[model samples]
Target chain A: MKTEAFVFDAYGTLYDVQSVSKITCEKFPRHGELITQVWRLKQLEYTWLRSLMNSYRSFWDITEESLIYTLDAVGVESDAATRAQIMDKYLHLDPHPDCHSALDALAGVPLAILSNGNQGILDTLVENTGLDRKLEATISVDKVGIFKPHAAAYELVEERLNVKPENVVFVSSNAFDACAAKNFGFRVAWIERVTRKAMNREVDEAEHVGPSTMFKLLRMQMEDLGMEPDYRLTSLNELVALR
Target chain B: MKTEAFVFDAYGTLYDVQSVSKITCEKFPRHGELITQVWRLKQLEYTWLRSLMNSYRSFWDITEESLIYTLDAVGVESDAATRAQIMDKYLHLDPHPDCHSALDALAGVPLAILSNGNQGILDTLVENTGLDRKLEATISVDKVGIFKPHAAAYELVEERLNVKPENVVFVSSNAFDACAAKNFGFRVAWIERVTRKAMNREVDEAEHVGPSTMFKLLRMQMEDLGMEPDYRLTSLNELVALR
Candidate 1:
């Protein structure tokens, strides 16, 4: 009930997949869509499979497996050479529109990114996202050798931040993770990008999926907990109200 | 695998959560959103919970329970009158765009709808979507007292169709059901909506889910000894191609 610090799921929560996909996607439109969707699907699958298989790989390594597996699943038949570009992009995604400033707006509240990736990958992400200096710390599952909802990954944040699960607001873009964390007794927040792609030109009227962005997700999380932000903003200026 | 028939999971597979929400979502748009989301979250939860409870309710009854539970979960302040309207609209949801024609096209395939719903509600849906008459038969959990992905529900279809599991082509919009059926050894066809829904300008894009007609999901059950669709359709019309 006492959320002193906030913990976030990195991949889909803090960064956007579509944005990450820009490298490959911007080059080949047809391949771009499949690349992002399949890569993401495989990344998640590998994370779970590694846990299920009792083998743990760093997020960077898993990114490789994800690319390979995604290509195989979709029958894209990519060679390792072409796949390196896709895997490499994972380290350099743009921070979501409101990311840094939004965190900046959180006043001095400690913020952390917990992931099922490796420390090296997390470091790269931090550097790319520019959160290395802004946020409190970064946490990854490599320490526990397990993915989240496993209690281990969640515990990693607890151990690192010294914040109890109830005191840490957990935000994740994955639905099952929210369900898992909530069930595990964390005051959880759902980032709401449940499915793979944004449904893009597919459904301009999808009603549930598309370009709502994470602002609403963050808003819903705040509303669910009855914690009104210092102020709501379309830009970093929203963070100003906190100051 | 020889498929004598195809089975579909209702709510998310053959239909969608927002599709039904369209009728009942106006009351407390905010609460309505939670209600719809949790209503869905609970339907699956109820099925799983009841499965674990070893006490079962028809999915229809469970849906009602979920809706009310969702209202409570999100703190919806609605009176009895509003609740009644939402409940009625649930069974009256029209099929997504091509549902009627899709059913008409699948005539020879001997399809059946297997839902957690009660027979009465199933009958109402059949009458409402008109997918009722076109379907060869409708099977509700009320008969067997079990929900889907449960081995028994799958068995009901096999028993009714007088075919082996390998001989059934299972179609569902619920991705999990499709995965479940595929894992359970049925020929699974995913009905991916390839259509798009234009935004209703009156609705803010933030609230706009976008796209009434969306890309219907389709994963053709393959020749792989493992996954096969046997048939795929955007509208049921593709069923004619089965011949």
Candidate 2:
């Protein structure tokens, strides 16, 4: 397809969620899990709710809102001290082990990190990972609150990177992030990592049987692209090396 | 609100996503992440896509389809043996630590697991987690392929649990799942836990935001129930201890 540039999704893909999580998670050993639980849950909810309502906010502001709601829900006193700590940590999250190497490998081509996050958050993320040196573009929808899959977000990358969605290799650990890029016609890659997902089961209440998740959407896209997954799976480093 | 019973959202709320993920992730390290990534991405996409396209399949089958496509995308081969291995694992997932104990605490109540999963898959999950042993009902939307947020799936729970929407306290870790339950007039509880959420980074994504998340949806619900978070956190034992 003559792909020239690789566009990456921020958060889980480039940076380790655990790394950012460690910021607040390490503080309150008691409420650490709950805090992250609230932050992520609300962060996602904020995005979806914004989309459905057609409202928009930068990921940073929403992150704050999520934090606020999380605190309130958990009955934690919403003090400036706690807020500052979280924001500071969030702003300087560490990069995934594979991030720098991957960015370094794709050094020559135009590479971008297109996120629903604001420019500030994106920059901080890249800078924290120290991979900012390699990026050709750092795109974010600062003016809009709309997230990915909305077309507008990807359009920013399209405009900034100046590459056909079809010719750009978009990567993310998030399935929906990839879906947005794929739907936009970008050649997307999902960097799936084994996260230490919590094992707290408050209630195995009603289980979900929704449609295939975003991750599955990529599968459908791969079939259309004639891409085949290797039965022999390898670590991200190895896979990236082979690629 | 004269609530009759509380129905919970299963997958993200009560049960861990790993149940289905381990099916593939264990066999293929990256495959687990890829499977979860794809499955989640596609599942959410399918819901929105089908909602937009006006066609639907049971969440279970959709899960399978997404798996096939994801396997192909990542270049992972899902032969009969591999597929069965992954598929069978769904029937034997280990419950989260808090699952059994909480189920034990809520034993006397008319608790149920409502999902859009296939009858067989849900049945198998129930057996695997030994969840059925603690609950009064296990509801599935097999008769209707339309998943959560769809009235039909909710109806399955309502019909089986014999609880009116308001009378029933619906618990789910999924924001959309909780929102839908609330929309259906059920008293919903967003289970607070640490789980990766599928997002496109939109602010409005909050529509589906589960109450229990980085913040603590459970705490929010507890507030609704006139209960306080007063240091009541952790496993079922600790939670009940507060009570």
Per-model lDDT = 0.59, 0.57
Indicate the docking level reached by candidate 2.
Answer: incorrect
What tens digits encode model 2's per-residue C-alpha lDDT throughout B1-243?
A: 554665656665566665675556577764465456555555554554443223456665566666665565555556878876775655666666677777677666677777766778888889777787877877876676655555766777666766667667666656556655665666655554532222212112433333212122522232221212222232333433322
For residues B1-243, what per-residue lDDT tens digits would candidate 1 score against the true structure? 455776777765566556656645688664444346545644664565454334566666677766665555344466778878888876776566656666666677788888777889888877787676668888876777766655677778777767788877777755445655776778777664432121112122323222221111111211112233444555545645542
Q: Every model's DockQ, to 2 decimals?
A: 0.07, 0.08
User: Please, what are the lDDT tens digits per residue for candidate 1 over residues A1-243?
Assistant: 455887777776677656756766654444555446545644664455345334566777777765654444334446666777766777887777767766777757888888776888888888876789877888877888877646667778778998888777777655546655665567766654322123222222333542232112211222221222222223333333322
Best model number under DockQ? 2
